[model samples]
Target: MRVISLQPSGDLTLSTDAVKPSPRPNHILVRVRAFAVNRQDLKIGPSVKDAGVECVGSVEDAGGVKGLRVGATVAVLSFGEGGLWKDYCLVPAKCVIPLQVSPATPGSPLDPATWAKLAAIPLTFLTAFGILDNLDLRKHDRLLIRGGTSSIGLTIASVAKALGAVVATTTRDPTKAPNLSENGADFVILEREGGIKDDVRMMFASKETFTSTDELSTPALSTTRINDSAGADKCVDLLGVNTVQDSLLALKGPGGICCLAGSLGGSGSTSFNPIKDIPSGVYLTTFAVDRVDMGKVPLQEIVDRVLERGEYRLNLDRIFGLEDLDKVKDYVEGNKARGKVVVVLPNEL
Candidate 1:
């Protein structure tokens, strides 16, 4: 089967290669209709694998996988730098989530891009909310999201807002603030990119005026954190290295968790004294969505949750065909698109 293979580190290219296409007992063969991109695939520097993951497609075939049939519309969850770019990629059945394959009736406002729009929101939002799920995010908690303009960051902010959390997002681009604000970011900080510790405290503190309102419903969080130097019950960092130290330094007292879910700013040693910068009570964890491999988490429940609510949204940057892959590859590698860049299969699909 022809596939897009990263022949060498940083050399992701499309090449045809023969393969024994089969599925594991718990796997399925997706006749890929569309695949989505995530920042995770773009920034993971080097690995032994041929390419990255984050795809959405259909079940062309199955591994005797139950509850899914051939011709069923579906989306693939790319765990290992996903394989959806190619015409046919075999994935574990657990990673495949079925969408309501049946199309809506005419004039139903049926959008062909519906699945693609929904596809891109998952990888990043899952990474964000899944990490928050670990932290027990409460609606009342002060959540600070840095790098708010990135797809992951924006998705995180959106999910948090939907859950009723007081979400504060930081971005240097003032132009992006309008959209972020519309999506539920209560506080949009025009960040200057340095000394964010105090900036974060101010962002979290800036919302105290609402404290007296009974209409507010938030999750379990310490109200004491409102204006303190150690505010922010949680910090969702989707940019990694550029923001980890500030996240740690800015976390509130006991139970303040810093979730590292991205490497967009590059990886490794951050400048900050763990002992001095991080409060003794603060918790730090590096989260990779793959960590959820062991549980019932991989099922289609979460995917369905987003679709059912109609709350999840994606920018749906552009769509490409399998034959137009060279152009698609160039745009993705160049980071030239605004949101999810999808590869759509031919009409034969």
Candidate 2:
């Protein structure tokens, strides 16, 4: 099998001599078609190791798994052991969601372009959906998605909007606002040079002051109250400690939930005084995609929605081949793409 492994020099090396992975009793062996790059891949440092987290492929062997069959198209979320960037990879049966590839039906076909799009969804969509699910999002609720231009951020905004929530997203670049808005953000808050917290507060203040009755009635923002603060019903904080305080401050008081789903900014510890940082009655929670229960993910519904829409709306910033592993690493490390970067594998060895 061909695999992309991290070398001792901290660079990814594609080698065709890699040993093929076999399926466990409860796992399936998949012949990967395409896989998406994620920020987590950067942490797989200087070691000779297989290092991908998600892919879309076909089941080469079911390994006695009852429901899965050979040759079935599947999307694999490699949480237990992160390595799907190869010709053959082992995936737990529970993490393998069979996809329908019929355009005449309620799903997408496994064409090259569609496979690339499907590759972009698993980890990103699952993480976003898990966060929103944890927050117990409701119709007409106002959601503030911090770091809205990132892949998961964009997916959260789109999924939340599809679920009838009025989505407000934050981006450091004002130029990305129109794109975010087109992707389902009702409001785009530009992070000011030095005062992101104040800028967020000001944006919410404007929402409170000028938001219309029709807007409030259109499953956008109803008269929802949590304590006395007039702000977002819930916030999806992807920037971690760097922006969590501002996220709490932008919520609609005590009943609001802030889901800390990522540390895209930095993972360093921060000092925060809860009494001063968190708003009264508000709740803070953390979500990790790998920690989420596979049984609880609405995989079928998510796929159905994507197919029904007839297109994958999440942006594909770039698609690289297996040979470009080093370039992919550099591009991701440099944060050069606003959306998901995928690696499409050749179907044959």
Candidate 3:
């Protein structure tokens, strides 16, 4: 079997003479089809043997797991345990979510293109779903997303739109504004080093409907003035500690909830005093994928929404081959990929 190994000097090496792994009692053997590259993969230590985290594959052996049969196509959401870079992986049953692919040929593997698209969904979409769940999102709610061009951020925006929320998002690059708008963001704000509080407030003020004073009930058509509390009712902050305070400033006070989800801007330490930092009656929370329970996550529904129903777009930036591991690392580390990056493994292996 072949696996990508992480060297101590921060390099990825393709090793072909590796022994194949077998599944334990609650695990299933999966033939790797494609795997998605994430920023989290870059932070793994040298002690870890195989490097990939999320992938889509065929169930080679069911390993006595109920509802899992041989030849079933499944998405592997291995947060950190399963070595998904290899040709075959032994993933725990709990981490595996079965997917239904309507193929032209029965029981055949999806084309590499479909595999690449599906591979982009698991980690990013699941993370967005978990964050939205934490936010207790409601229909017609005003939702704001920071780091709008990120894969997870895009997913959050699309899902929030599907749930009937009015979406607004931020991006550092002005060129990426159209992409954000196309992906369900009703308003796209160009982020600045100073902050986006004034821009968001200005947007709200300029677009007020003047029909009512209840801005919280209808932010899209609120009559609230710019000087008033014109801000997003719910916010998903992906920029992490660096911009959390700014996010708080942009949020509607007294009842708004801000969920700090991703660390795209780098998770540096920051001094904090909740009494001074958080506004009165507003809530602050954090979401980590490691704390998510697979049984509770609606992975199957998310896949259906993105792939089957066409409710969400698959934010696939680029697809690479197993041998192009270095290029994958460069694309992600350079912060060039606008969305998810995936690597498709050849079946001949």
Candidate 2 lDDT over residue span 1-349, tens digit each: 7878766676787778877786678889998999998878767554677788788888999989887789898888877678777899887688788876654434544667767877887788888888988999999888888889998999888888878998889888878888898888898988654535555555555332333446437756544532355677789989888778878877765587899988877877878777778877899998988887777777766776775563436667899887778889999898677789998887669
**Ranked candidates (lDDT, high to low):** 3, 2, 1
Q: Could you tell me which residue pairs clash in candidate 2? A: 254-281
How would you encode candidate 3's per-residue C-alpha lDDT over 91-185 as one tens digit per residue?
Answer: 77888889887664666658888888889998898899899999999998888899999999988998899899989999889888988888889
TM-score of 1: 0.79
Ranking according to TM-score, highest score first: 3, 2, 1
Task: Write down the TM-score of every candidate.
Answer: 0.79, 0.86, 0.90
> How many angstroms is residue 13 displaced in model 2 relative to the true structure, after the best TM-score fit?
0.6
Off by over 4 Å in 3: 44-48, 104-107, 206-228
lDDT of 3: 0.84
**Whole-model lDDT values for every prediction:** 0.67, 0.79, 0.84
The per-prediction tally of clashing pairs is 10, 1, 0
Report the C-alpha lDDT of model 1 over 1-349, residue by residue, as the tens digit. Answer: 5566544354456666647367667778876555665444444445534454756666767788778887776666766546566667888776776766334554453245665655565566667668788768987888888777776777777778778788888776778788778767888877665747787675555333224322454444414434333468888877677678777777776668888777666676766666776677888877777776523554355555566555655556688766775676678776565556776555452
**Worst 10 contiguous positions by lDDT, candidate 3:** 206-215
Candidate number achieving the greatest TM-score relative to the actual structure: 3
